[model samples]
Target: MATHLTRRGSIYYLRRRIPLHLTEQYNGKREITRSLGTKSRPEAERLARAISVELDREWQAASEAAAMTAEGKGKPKIDPRYYDLAGAYELAELEEQHAAEVDELHADADRLEKLLAIVERRREQASAGNASKAATISAEARKPRSGAKGNSVSLESVIELWRRDRQPTAKTVDAVTRAVREAGDPDIHAVSRQVVIAMRDKWIEAGNSVATVNKKIGFIRLLLGIAKSRGMIDSNPAEGAELPPPKRAVELRKPYDPEQAEAVMAATAAMQATDPAMYWLPRLARWTGARLNELHQLRVEDVQERDGHPGLLLTNEGEHADGVAMALKNDGSRRWVPLAGPVLGFAMWAKGRTGPLFPAKANKYGNVSDSFSKRYGKLLRNVVKITDKRVTFHSWRHGFADMCRHAGVSAEVRMALMGHAEGGGAAAAYGAGDGLPPAMLIDGIKRINGDSA
Candidate 1:
């Protein structure tokens, strides 16, 4: 066998011993082992067999090249008319290098056939005394010719364009830039499949989650795609280089129960009494089902009347007052959530505030949502003492939806109130109406409060 399949815990790897002669040339390297990127033994074996064949071809070509390079070996006979013995020797060495390159790249058979035909023609010239033709070919091979412009796509340029255009948070963009830099920031087109796979493996070895590593791969593809579209590179090397699915399943956040909901409200009220305006965030998120940062980053003017009804508006419009430019998570996130019940007091309090309603938390992460998420999770775990790991701040959104469903709120009203995407036939219902009135949204909010209203 050219190579063997080895199991590392559950996953399989392809392992091949390096040839003895080339081992020294590789600085004492002994084996080449690669993860087959599969957990199924059968699939791993199938992938292994194909890769093993490629490795054998590579090693055979290397061995032949090494033998030809041996001192006083494979000497060519001189025939001055057709070709000089010196030129034949040089051509032999070049052919050896070309063969090894073809094996390494797994180039098409037709390309290898073309290289062989060139070698045969050179040999015929040496035998039949075609010195001028042989010399011309050799000289041309040595001359420098302009190739494609892929190499000009610089690492710095891709990074700049991605940061400027994509507008990811500082934490996200900086992490992506750091990963690319750690990968040595190769030219965009030069990031071959092998290089990208190795980079992903490095992340896995460093204990990064599969999801996080996948996002990194996405960033690499996105950055390189930008360069390719502008003709800077031949293609995006990172395209289609996705890793296998993770072993673990994704866990969804669970909803807060009624007692737990009451505890949260009590916490908010305590904070509100001493809370001033700071305590209003929970109430606003509860009443409107708006995101934590959506409420946290609100300006005084965000309080507006839509369709002649008073409500709090959630918009992707950035920089409430020439502040940091913030965008919504997606198009579905931008909508007007009606404000009512306890949230009315909070809106009245912010009627004329010039700056952000919660400036302190908003400025911390350049991502107030992220900062609030951590603090809220800690509040639930440490203070509120809710031990359910599945529940988090995101669960409040689910709780609102649950309340709307239990209260028999029309699907259209529920989707409109929570900014959820209306799907299928239900979308027409929303369009058929002028808009959801604040009174209807208040009824739903009151249902969430268990008729305390």
Candidate 2:
């Protein structure tokens, strides 16, 4: 049986019919009760449904305790069949739910660990591959032989090397430097044909003559040759580059006839009254078939007058710093050019003592042509119908040589006077002086200047 009471509009229950002493000995002398808070009996009965389940669990626990006590009395005890169906079922279900939650948490941790490992392995492989490729590329780039390594090998370096090793004339060096600086890349091993061709086109567009552009290309070719020899490049790209052929055939500007020569001499003399230096330079060139450079480097000491007989001494100091030694254009140009009569008088009148004979403000031979052209180019062009031609001071040598031929000078004498190499096998074999004697050269000059032999 169970006891029931109503308090605060709620129903309460307590197990009954057991003595207080038995209850204290069997359970713990505490009241076993449950509350069902409701206003009506029906509602209270409905709320007391869970109380019945708690009462059953309490009854079973007490019965188990009494049975264990009886066993301890050393007497055979009867087993009681009792079950707390609600409590047992509810506890079993809670344990199952806890186990399921633990299993799900463990599976999630394992999946995340595997994903992290895969990502780490992929990153390592990618890094190693990139490192290997970088190393290979670096090695290949360094293997090729190039001009003086590092960033310092620049266009300036190329120009400096040309200046030091090629020993080019100042004009030649300046022209080459200008072209190289303007047309080539400093880091590139050799200049490309495309770059050179483009430069050619640009020069032509800028109103430069084909001959001038060709000359510039010639310097670029020389630079490429040096670069190739040094293993800076595998090949010379400019080797196959095309340039415009020289314009105005060489034969068009033929030698002057005797009458034309006389007229030129008269024209030159008449122009002397205004510009003496300009006038005398061409006169001396006509009298002596000397190259423009030879005349520019002529000195007062080189001109010696012995017994009223004048002769020019040609010296070859073999590439001097100062223009003291007379280095001929080639081996054939090493011979002395004899001076006499008007030519001798002209040389003496130009320079009295130890200095350049035909010294211009700029002593270089290249500038002398420019100086002459600026002053008398139009005048000469008006006098002669010299069209579509680039004429320099050296044309006077051709004029003088042609004049000698027309004046009936022998071929041998002409060759000797012009310092040309003799072609005869015997003279070449014996190393005989192929040049004329000083007296004969003086006699030849006199003949050309309208004097008797």
Best candidate per TM-score, number? 1
- How do the residues 103-169 of candidate 2 rate in per-residue lDDT, one tens digit apiece? 6468659976985587456546655544454334333323434443334244335666665554445
Worst 10 residues of 2 by lDDT: 1-10
Tens digits of lDDT, candidate 1, 191-306:
56566676666667657888788888887787778887777766666787877676675555777888998898887666754644437776676667777767776877878775
- How do all models score by TM-score? 0.54, 0.50
- Pairs that clash in candidate 1: 82-129, 82-130, 271-275, 272-275
Q: Residue 80 of model 1: what lDDT?
A: 66
| Angstrom error at residue 166, model 2 | 2.9
Please identify model 1 stretches exceeding 4 Å from their true place.
Answer: 1-149, 164-171, 231-240, 244-247, 276-278, 316-327, 330-332, 340-342, 352-355, 361-365, 368-374, 388-390, 401-453
lDDT of 1 at 331: 49
